[model samples]
Target: MRTAVGIDLGGTELRAALVAEDGRLLARRSTRTDAAGGPEAVLAQMTGLVADLDLAGARPVAVGVGAPGPLDAEAGVVTGPPTLAGWHGFPLRERLAAALGLSVAIDNDGHAAALGEWRFGAAIGRRHFVYVTVSTGIGGGVVCDGRLLRGRGGLAGHVGHMIVTDDDVVCSCGNRGCWEAVASGTAFGRQARRAAAADPAGRIAALAGTAPADARHVGTAAREGDPAALALVAEEARRLGAGIVGLIHLYSPEVVVIGGGLSALFDLFAPVIADAVATRAMPAFRDVAVVPAALGPDAGLVGAAALVLAPN
Candidate 1:
């Protein structure tokens, strides 16, 4: 029962967990990420967290980190992560290794989550698969041949930045008409708010207690049977399913697991995404089963800790 530490870094806080080789979460905790002080300060706090966990005598092989993307995993450097300001060109893996005196591996957060799910979650017993999480942005990861398929530089799963439609919306990635701009949780929520504002009958307005402005509100309204909210959700499902179609064409996975707060409405969206995939994806790709992520909110930490147990 060896253990390793897995860190999930984000714009607001950093979550670390001690995970056993078999996917049990032995210990888990979190700390706020100070955006003003930048990556160095965050790194310091992260190291302190690992120290607090008392891993000084642990036998885990390595530390696995799930970080915001656009990173240079091989070089251990963060080229530029837009969500976290001043993280440009930061030596993430090297800095953590030096701070913890342990080998460190860094990955795009989505890829890490996908790896986590594959190793120990619903993705178990599956071969080719795709993972999509819609939070601050729509993040994705690919698993092929029972291994994570991060592309060169590990930015391969930047599905949010993919241009699915030629709509006029702009993505944070600075690309016009990117999928994130149109169908991400951010976008889903934004659209719901707009509709609610224009039409007081929209359910998201009441659910948010005042015309909410994030996908969570929309999903809640959809669950409650709001017409406007349901339409928005339908759009989200189609958009998300379209993305799944692309992955199916590329990897031909046995299953597609989707998670994140927004995915709570999987019952409402799965059919739409499934319908879209069937309509658009090739026949061979059509048979893939699309399902909800087995692990809930803590998938990243669970999967990350498992990274330490990977045999060399």
Candidate 2:
């Protein structure tokens, strides 16, 4: 089977994989990102990981990368994603291509994930859809009329940054009331931590103990039928659903696929999201399906590979 190299470069971790033509991940390796070590260190780490995947014996024809955004996909340059400090204006595609001695393609992680789903996952056969990853912060990709919607500078599908509410919480993008600011996994954790501090005897507090709490603690408490945890999750789902409703109104997509770290709790969030859309979305767009991503955590990796395996 023909194969390619795919990389998912994130703020905390760097993952590399060998993906077959059919989207199966044949081999994979990952390491914690050396953000403190700067771009050169990260590049060396990434190259070493790719070399290790090469030993798996599938001569990859090309390489594809899904990197954090504010990037110029057309120019193959990374223009300073907040999470990836020191990557401003770096020619990622060209550097990787030269190092690997092969063709290389790169795009925003959200766009890559969307392409993966469109080509090999849940959004298959759908001409209109949106893929949203709700993790540390929200990120998204859109497929319109069977094509990835890459707006000017490849910044089109930044649905997370969309102003979804009236709130004081500032998003990493230095904005107030962004969907990500209110509904992302980071936001959920922050809220949980505050709630736990206020209610020392509550179930959420008991689950979190003294350590920093995140969305996972909330999920655990919710599963145990804790009322506060359940309420927090419900509110998060509502916020996420509210943003998704906007996407439906704007893009008229057939389905909205949810992925990322929080997707592990998709079963918990799905019903609430459905209700938000049903009640708030315009009557004409309420029929859109909101579902979990089919590829789960592998979506980014497979989607990155799709960049090289199947170009726009």
Candidate 3:
């Protein structure tokens, strides 16, 4: 079977995989991203990972990378994604190609995830769909009429930056009231921390341990039936639902697939999200399915591989 090298580059982690054309992951490795060490260090880490995979003898046809963006996909350059410091205008494609001696493709992580799902996961056979990842931050990708919708500057699916509130929560994008600012895992953690500080008796304080409160703690607390944590999760669901409504209005996708680390809480949030979308969306859009991504954390890596196996 023909194979390809796939890399999912995130702010904190780097995942590399050898993926067959049939969407099977043959071998994979993951490690911490040397993001604080700057772009050169990140490149070295990626190169090493790819080299390890290459030694498996698959002889990949090309290398595909799914990375945090604000990127120039056409030029194969990263254009200052907030999560990845020191990567502005970095020639990621060129560097990878030079290091691996193979053709390379790059895209926004969200877009890659969407493509991955469309090709291999939840959105399979769906002509129009959206993939949203609600992790430390939120990001999204849209597929319209069976093609990935990469806007004029390859920045089309930045749904997280869509303003959702009038509150003063600032986003890493330097904006206030973005959906990410108020509803992402980071936002949920921030709210949990404040709640814990305000009410020392709350479950969040106990669950937080030595580290600061985060979305995981909130989810754990909710699962354990902590009222405060349950409330927080509900609020996040509402916010996320509101955003899904907006996406439905804009793209009219047949389904909206939610992924990322926070998606583990989908069972807790899906009902509220479904209700919000059902009630608030236009009558015509009320039936749109809101579902968890089937590919899980592998979506980006598989989607990155699709860049080489299926370019659309």
Candidate 4:
């Protein structure tokens, strides 16, 4: 079976894996992204990682990278993604290709995750689906007619920036009322902290532990039956659901897969999300299944592999 090298580059860490054509991970390695050192340092770390992924005798056909975007995928350049400072216009694909002596393909992490699910996880055999990751921020990827829907500039599927409210919260993209600004993990964290500060005697504050309050603390408090935390989580779910409803109205996908760090709390929020979609989506779109991603944390890595093994 043919194999390929898959690299998932995030704001804080980088993961590389050798994956077979059938989607099995063969070997893997990970390291912190030296993002503070700038793009050159990050590139060096990526190259070194690829060199270290003992592929044995199975030579990789190509390298596939799933990186945070606002990138020019066609040109293989990073275009000022807020997560990666000093990466504006950096020729990541060309640099990786030169260092690894292999052709490289790159796309936004959200697209890669969607592709990965389409190829080997929840959306398999489905011709139309959407994948949304809600973490520090929200991002999305869409597959229609069995093909990834990268727009003319490979900038499609950025569902996070879609306006969902008239609130004053500003997004990292500098937009107010973006879906991400109101519904992402960052938003949850901010809200949780505010709630904690407002009610110093509440369980929400104690649930936060020594760390700053975040979505996870909200989940913990909710799980422990804190009504205030439950209400906050419910609100987050509703906001997220509103975005998914918009996506459903636009794409009419067969399935919507949710992933990312915040998805760990899916159980607490899934019902609210499902209810919102069922009640708010158009009749024809109501049947769309909203599901959790099956590949878990490996979705990006596998999706990166799919970029080379099953280019779309």
In Å, residue 186's CA in model 4 sits off its true spot by 0.4
TM-scores for all candidates: the values are 0.93, 0.97, 0.97, 0.98
**lDDT by residue for model 1 over 9-61, one digit each (tens)?**
87787888888888877777788888788888898889888777755466666
Clashing pairs in 2: none
lDDT of 2: 0.90
Q: Tens-digit lDDT track for model 3 on 243-282?
A: 9999999999999999998899999999999999889999
Q: Model 1: which ten-residue window has the lowest total lDDT?
A: 303-312
**Whose TM-score is higher: candidate 3's or candidate 4's?**
4
**Candidate 1 Cα errors over 4 Å, as ranges:** 54-58
Model 3 spans > 4 angstroms off: none
lDDT against the true structure, per candidate, is: 0.80, 0.90, 0.91, 0.91
lDDT of 2 at 154: 83
Tens-place lDDT digits, model 2, residues 74-179: 9999988999888999999898888889889999999999988888899988989999999998998999987899989888899899998787889999999999
Clashes of each: 2, 0, 0, 0
lDDT of 4: 0.91
Error of 1 at 81 (Å): 0.7
